[model samples]
Target: MRTLEALATGTPLVASDYGLEGLSVDSPGTPLGAMRANDVDEYVYAVGRLFQDEKLQEKLSNNGRALIENEYAWEQMTQRYEQVLLDTCSKYLVESQE
Candidate 1:
């Protein structure tokens, strides 16, 4: 979920609308950006676009790596879980909150 959010915040995505279904962001595509890869062909097309186009590669590289750094990174993800637990306990005031 966090990765998706990060990706959305960055470059275009090649994912199914169903893949995007039940998510927060409404618009995930742009005129020359984010696309849906519901099948092998769409995926190949999107990837081809990335490779054949230098700008696309730059976009994917920058955005995808940023996603990894910001969300998929082990330390960052761990922090999210830790914060969730702390927030839950703080809200409920449980003895185990410590």
Candidate 2:
């Protein structure tokens, strides 16, 4: 939730892999929305790099905000959840009629 908030606000991120688990941010073949770091040294390096690199920061900020708008916004999430429930109900009805 916190991560989503940051992304929604277009804030650049330096988060641990575990902190971003299950998110599409660092998925294979996708652009990263946050810098991934797992240790203190890595975190420090990532933060420093992000701070020093304005282009990287802007890229991350835009990507993160776009990700949230496309995938995690309330409208998008509600639609996905509604579809899941509808599919489940339809499957159950078909099975019960069999």
Candidate 3:
């Protein structure tokens, strides 16, 4: 989350996919930096890629921020949770009636 947030902020970030499970970032052995056993190489390469290729990094950073801001806002997230909980409880009540 932090790495993604950093990326979203246009701040330099390095991340291993392990910490950010389920979110696959296609770049290094990890997502951004040192997470692999030979992470040093992957890390250097990933960061270097960002420095060397400004456009790609900018795209990722903007995309990341847009994603979180639009899709993962706490209000929206909690609404999803509330809907799920309400549905589950409703189902439980219906089944209990039987």
Candidate 4:
């Protein structure tokens, strides 16, 4: 949720690589490619990169904001959850009939 907030606000971010089971990083079309840090050195490097490169920062900020607005909005998330529940129930019903 913190990441979502930062993305929504167009903040370039550096974050730990752990605990992001559902969050995607390091994708070709994603702004989080270089922002996932596995250690202190990687974290420092990521922050330094953001600090030194204004163009990169701007690109990440724009992409992050767009990603959140398009994919992570509250309505979109709720729809996805509802779809998952419906699919799960359908599968369970089908299996039980066999």
**Number of backbone collisions per candidate, in order?**
2, 0, 1, 0
TM-score of every prediction relative to native: 0.52, 0.91, 0.68, 0.77
When 3 and 4 are scored with TM-score, the better candidate is: 4
* lDDT of each candidate versus the true structure: 0.63, 0.90, 0.62, 0.77
**Which digits, one per residue and each the tens of the lDDT, describe model 4 over residues 1-94?**
7877887898886777553445665567655523778798988888898889999898778877887888889899999999999999999999
By TM-score rank, best first, the candidates go: 2, 4, 3, 1
Please list all clashing residue pairs in model 4, or write none if there are none.
none
Q: What TM-score would candidate 2 get against the native?
A: 0.91
Please give the lDDT score for candidate 3.
0.62
Candidate 2 Cα misplacement greater than 4 A, ranges: none
Model 4 residue 31 CA deviation in Å: 4.9
Number of the predicted model whose lDDT against the real structure is largest = 2
Show the lowest summed lDDT stretch of 10 residues, model 3. Answer: 29-38
**Candidate 1 Cα misplacement greater than 4 A, ranges:** 1-35, 91-98
- Estimate, for each residue in 1-98, the C-alpha lDDT of model 3 and write its tens digit: 67556645755455665654565444445233222223788888877877888776766666556656665678878999999999999999999999
In terms of lDDT, model 2 sits at 0.90
- Give the backbone clash total of model 3: 1
